[model samples]
Target chain A: MATLKDVAAKSGVTVTTVSRVLNNRGYISEETRDKVYLAMKELNYQPNEIARSLSKQKSNNIGIIVPHIEHPYFARLIGYLEREAVKKNYKIILCNSHAKFEKEIDYLEMFQSHRVAGIILCSRSVDIGKFVSLNIPVVSIERPVDVGTTSVECDNYQGGILAAKHLIARGCRHLVHFSGIENEAMPADARSKGFIKVCEDNNILHKEVESKADDYLNMEYHSLIESVLKENPEVDGIFASSDLIAAQVIQVARKMNIQVPDQLKIVGFDDVSIASLVSPTITTIHQPIKEMAQEAINCLIKCTEDSVVPSRIQLPVSLIKRETT
Target chain B: MATLKDVAAKSGVTVTTVSRVLNNRGYISEETRDKVYLAMKELNYQPNEIARSLSKQKSNNIGIIVPHIEHPYFARLIGYLEREAVKKNYKIILCNSHAKFEKEIDYLEMFQSHRVAGIILCSRSVDIGKFVSLNIPVVSIERPVDVGTTSVECDNYQGGILAAKHLIARGCRHLVHFSGIENEAMPADARSKGFIKVCEDNNILHKEVESKADDYLNMEYHSLIESVLKENPEVDGIFASSDLIAAQVIQVARKMNIQVPDQLKIVGFDDVSIASLVSPTITTIHQPIKEMAQEAINCLIKCTEDSVVPSRIQLPVSLIKRETT
Candidate 1:
């Protein structure tokens, strides 16, 4: 039941002085140090584990920043990261940016203040310069930063190509690709690029629908798909950027009386659980989420051990054929 | 670019003494303190935030424990809790219990060592006594603890009754209620209690299928539902404890050639995003997840301020009738 204040009062010193003795910090004279120790013994004070990391100028905690854990992609990734961190007796300090620029900045500053051993960022609106200046080991997931910064991502371009090829193989003449909101320079932009390149090479007609950045949590995918379908009524196939968007496409198509596979074949990316949960079992490009998450942690561990780290680690993606295609 | 060691070396004192000066902890002679301060100013050392919290014996952080963040229900709840915690400038240290008892205890001990201001437990396999003994203010979500413990949960009994009433109102004669795994002492058992009471009140034929607690994350709903349906082919109604279960029922029913709403009516609890995402749109009891999360945070803050929190705060649940019912 004894507290730091109780020990302070018993030892004839300020709580700060007692804390200093307990932390083995500050210029505590041998006499004062002995007195503080006697008071702690008499009070049965438990000097907590926090002081170990503080004196060492490091911690066994990894700061993980994501857009939101509620998103399936992020949740699954966090699960894997947690698995790895737990193995090393490292705790996770999780921050949800909630797609806000200010929040991400605040978290970055907080992580720095906490002196977390490392940080894994899946930020959407971060200032790259501020992040690079932190001087902590960082392994970004999906979102690639500048050179010398490590990042782990799936082969998004190959995913796009596989999607396009699958849809085309299913005898689709016209195509529409839904790209979730992205930075002009993000690696995910590569998904649409590959789709466009493949379509262009084959001389197949296609169009790309880019979602606004803010459209993720409050997705207007239904309206977006509805309008695109109305405008491109002749479109026979869709290569959606994500499975959730593809599921939305399926819903809109159902309402529009456009039969999947029979009349409007569709392929989705990121074969998340929802891909199979949906009735038609979405045909998707499966990006090895668990593998990518492991790679990110591995890269972070390597960086944490030293500044040397591979700039990029991209995993392969494969196609999962289902009823939708 | 200067390190703590550098500052200590320049100040002609041990790093512990310099750290003590930086943390304002322990006794330091005026001259020694001034020397450490001058060295810090020279090195431009940024006194980290972690040490400030350590000296204060408190932190602006909450430890959040859940069965698994990848589970939709937990993910959504965590998202709402994160939003509330961030508003108070408190960081969240997240842990997924992964349905393990030891992991829950390990996390609890870790949270104690870190001296978190509070904890919000959505644990499935925790010892209530162990949690209560930590002397930390805790707000348990869904899983109720002993009397005088703070907790926030939906009106589960009402949720069950609503499901039963909806099914009966839709002219369902032969009924079945799927009860998720529950400890006999848990308040969530009230859900099945209400369901059975409603069915008995209506003189309707019904059976309860209890799911094992271990079957949650790796759900065996498909095989379980298949056997139940095979044995009770005339079952025309179902009140599932969670939307995931109801989704499973829909999938099973489809394969069994049973038509939703036309031949069988189903109602589910915890109207998570998946309730609407699934085709046939599950009719579910909406548990007001966001409001519940806010209430949990409010209760924790109250308890942390002055151990005077209410024992229990229950939110209302409503039926969202979609295509399934």
Candidate 2:
């Protein structure tokens, strides 16, 4: 933690001058004020009020980073987090990293300089090795960061297994799974593992269509689904990792004149609003968003109190059967 | 804004004690520290760093109040605003008022004491007369506060006209519109105005179902759509005030075995992602989200330079014809 003395020394100003600038009690030139503020920022000189809380070893503010606020899951997650934080007398400062590693770094630096008490990260940053250097308590949400910090994640592997089992129960032997490309940093690809394992155990033939990250648009999914359906004309069941992808699959399936549930049975994951709003009301896996948010906040608060938090917190996921299956 | 003197007075402590506590120097009892922090919060004393920016007449921080981040429109709008704010080296502290008047008041007070450079409001607060007393510049987004404040809103009235005209052009004789209940503070009800006026001028028999504000679940919408259809099964065209409402209408209509675009044509407002994701992709009025966010930021920045800003800015909305109409 930097102090006023450090700022004064770095800016080559007297302690009295720095105090006057901070208090706004005396006349100061624009250049001098700019120099003081810049030096303070450079040295991470937290203001007296927040600094008091910082000295107490925590702040009443928690920083949260999510990939994109527009995503339904993240939006709802943040809403729940804010409500929980308010109940705990904490403020939430949101950072949308947009799945970019550099922006993630920028927000982390900002959080460091501002001295937020903790962080709840649902970031998609692949290069998060630098996170270990962060001094603040951290709680991971969905995305696993490092070895020490606790993470609140839905049972993606179990969710994937349910999807596979449901499709099989629907009497679809030739199945396909839409999986995102594997990332070492994020353990969400466990969905792929569960799906593949189940298919192998059942001696069922399955195809996997992998997608790159940050592919919000269905262009890649559209092309991939088109090619997969073209090559494997016998494919009858499709399990998509996300409802958005499932909706797109239905769109492409409709365009290709494939009657859903009759010739093709589909199941999706993350029973967000889009799952029900889409036509045929996708049968999907329901990740408890509100419960997960509460658990994440509780984990961070535990870290604040005892500095010892769990390594992982896995919530249960259930299959929501709608019209698709 | 409350000064340190006010906090000391409120806490019934000496000025030196408060200063020492703030600076985190010298011995201070835990109870005394609690008293000081509480007094500062009660008096609304901003931290020195933000207060310094207040004294300098501008800040690199901006306060934003929106109804809720979970709303797709607001989530995407916030995403764009944050990107633009980052480009301009400004930080956004988001306040999700969640359609609560008290929370909106709380955020406004926080902004006032913290001395943000400006405010970009998409709040649902009806009584905004107190905003005139806000010293900082303000830019209203989506919802207009009052006179003498600049606002960014889509041409909702024109959107209604476009939808009505398109439905008529598609050979619809009878029509029905699902509208949000009229709000004096929010001018969004103009969508219904345009729809009704065009229908009256053309002497078309039309019905309307209105939902109350903050009624997100669409229970009112479901019952209203049901009754409206039962009374007027001859309704050949329908227009919903928003894409979310339109999507709900589609869901309920599907349950009733009403084939979209064949028995009933539908048009939605605010072409959010849900419009395209749903089966029978909604034909909606596309509100230029990114451009509007940029314009809102521009308006706030302009207010910082010159004290005066325009009363309202209405961006154009284009109808996106998909499978529905």
Which is the leading candidate under DockQ?
1
Q: For model 1, what is the alpha-carbon lDDT of residue A44?
A: 57
Query: Which pairs of residues clash in candidate 1, taking residues 3 or more apart in a chain or in different chains?
Result: none
Supply candidate 1's per-residue lDDT for B22: 76
Tens-digit lDDT string for candidate 1 (B1-325): 5678999999999999988887688999999999988998897676676677787777778999998778888878988999899898788999988878898877887887788889998986356674566667888899886665688889999988888989999999999988867564444588988888899999999999887766777754788888999999999999888888888898888788899879989898888877887787889999999999999998888877885778889999999999898
Question: Could you say which candidate leads in TM-score?
Answer: 1
Q: Alpha-carbon error at A324 in model 1, in Å? A: 0.7
Computed on alpha carbons, the lDDT of every model, listed in order, comes to: 0.84, 0.79
Query: Best-fitting candidate, measured by lDDT?
Result: 1
DockQ of each: 0.47, 0.18
Worst 10 residues of 2 chain A by lDDT: A49-58
In order of the candidates, what TM-score does chain B achieve? 0.84, 0.79
